[model samples]
Target: MNRHGQRIGEPASRWRMQIVPIATVMIASALPLMLPLVASSPVLPPLGLLFFLSWQLLRTEMWPVWIGLPLGLWDDLFSGAPIGTAIALWTAASIAIAYLSQRIYWRGFLHDWAIGALLVAAVQALAVFITFPHAPAGHMLGLVLPQIIISVLLMPLFLRLTGKFDNFRLKRR
Candidate 1:
């Protein structure tokens, strides 16, 4: 029994695993609000959080869907998008990650980075397709390509920073 005298099956401390996820949602919601003022902010398309959550999805013990709803609601509120649109998209992506999680190991830092990039691209494409199907091809490509590239480049570093926070529980196989 822990100091609380609770059964060992219960987590002795969840604060360790909760901080980053909560902060991620908050930042994801607020970043878009700052985009209009910041000429060259690194956070865009809100895919950095998506990539981060995707990384978590690969863990057997955790599910991305658990985080998706709140993050999506935050995105909807902060972004100009329809109330549930971002939520639906994020929830779907989380489900996809969960399904794929069982099949892939995502073994190395580079691998995680690559997966993050591709997933970010996919999220951008999906969001665009859902929101603005009639938008010009060049416009869509112009926006998505840069965001994807930046997300890919920065993902490793962001992961390293967040990883240092030591939040979230990933079961070891």
Candidate 2:
């Protein structure tokens, strides 16, 4: 590259794309797990991961199908959801994003992320409604709504930074 004096190119293998989001989700999961011990306020919930999935959906260069299975397994183990449930949900969402992506630019990180948050909230509510009928709907609104709002608010900055980092890394390669 001109500034770095390094050869610039696309990632040689698909594995590189897989690594970044997996690592990111794991770190995000850890924050939620640790926040009760570390702070007064609640930690950022999994909306960011959902938004990250949407970002991957919008990206033409990387298809994240392979990453979804392992990440969903990790989420299932970590979040105490039913086995394969998160995987199924995430895969469905990714598929939906991919389909919708064909129609929209998805270039606006904030707008896309806000839409992702809405999807996350709606999907989570539906999941609970069908699978855990005994659970009160009120609980979902009380807990999930605020988290969705927070996630929507936080997504722009994260997407921007990650986009920049990806560009930088691509340039370096």
Candidate 3:
């Protein structure tokens, strides 16, 4: 029994919850890549990053610094982003979130939403800058604005979903 007088399950079941974050984020990262032709648009928000940020903000302890590398590599492979781009960006974002969590003692949905928006916008801008360094400002804005707006708008939904996942992970077997 745990400290609260609850009986824990087998070792495997207890361990299963540990993989939930990485597994879910990795899977979410591939979602944009598998889209059917009809839904293919440059404006589609980066689901993987959205999920990653959501998970990080919701449960900072579950995501350690090192996991970013493999997850970023997975994103790089599937998203067709330049090699090492996601690696650097993902790691940086994770670190930023960790720092933010430490600096801010109290957090709310609005705060998370704002941070998520800024991070999503920054990632999108960096990716575009890296991929199309010479692209016109107007063109870049046109391509990225929709994605940023959508990502920001979806932050609440993602947070809700992550919370549900957390509930599942912590549920007694």
Candidate 4:
């Protein structure tokens, strides 16, 4: 034992092991707001959601369901969406994925990507409805459809990045 009562060879804490994953997701969540606002139509993928799901699928045990509350709230604040929207959706998605991952024994990257596509399409479509309730369906779909496509297509990249982040976080100092 050392002066602080911890074992001499033991780490004081393993906080750094968690920093990379959480930071990546948080930064991805805030990406849209970091850009200059010039486009008449939505173009950026829902990177926040994609990255969040990527982490969840990559490591189901890394975070608890409630983790979504704070992360989603952060996304809402930065994405200019109403508060509570992301909180609810992200929390719900977390719970759902936890359940699904537990129930399924046969899993692979393509399976994860398909699940991500379903969630992304649904969530992105819902966001459009919430953001433009008064707009015609065709107009809203036109604006968000491309974004959904991009988000779905980008799922693999985010998933791979999550794996890299996991490896980086676990690397020996």
lDDT per residue, candidate 1, 35-59, as tens digits? 6556442336564365445446434
Ranking of predictions according to lDDT = 4, 3, 1, 2
The lDDT of each candidate is: 0.62, 0.60, 0.82, 0.85
User: Against the hidden reference, what TM-scores do the models get?
Assistant: 0.72, 0.73, 0.88, 0.88
Better of 2 and 4 by lDDT: 4
lDDT of 4 by residue, 1-173 (tens): 65655664564336757777788878988877888877888888878888899999988898988988999998898887788888888888899899999898799989999999888888888877877789999988988898889889999998998888887776544
User: What are the per-residue Cα lDDT tens digits for candidate 3 across 1-173?
Assistant: 88865686633346558877777888898887677645334777788888898988898878687667888889889877788778888889889999999999799989988888888889878887777788897788688888889888998899899999878787666
Q: Provide C-alpha RMSD values for all models, in order.
A: 5.1, 3.7, 3.3, 4.2
Q: Report the candidate with higher lDDT, 1 versus 3.
A: 3
Error of 1 at 149 (Å): 1.4
lDDT of 1 at 50: 53
Better of 1 and 4 by lDDT: 4
Which predicted model would earn the best TM-score? 4
Instruction: Write out the backbone clash pairs for model 1.
Output: 17-168
lDDT of 2 by residue, 1-173 (tens): 45765545634335554555556666664555655455333345574365356456446446555555666677777665677777777777777776667777645756577667666766666555655667788875665566666666665666666676455434423
- Please give the clash total of every predicted structure, in order: 1, 3, 0, 0
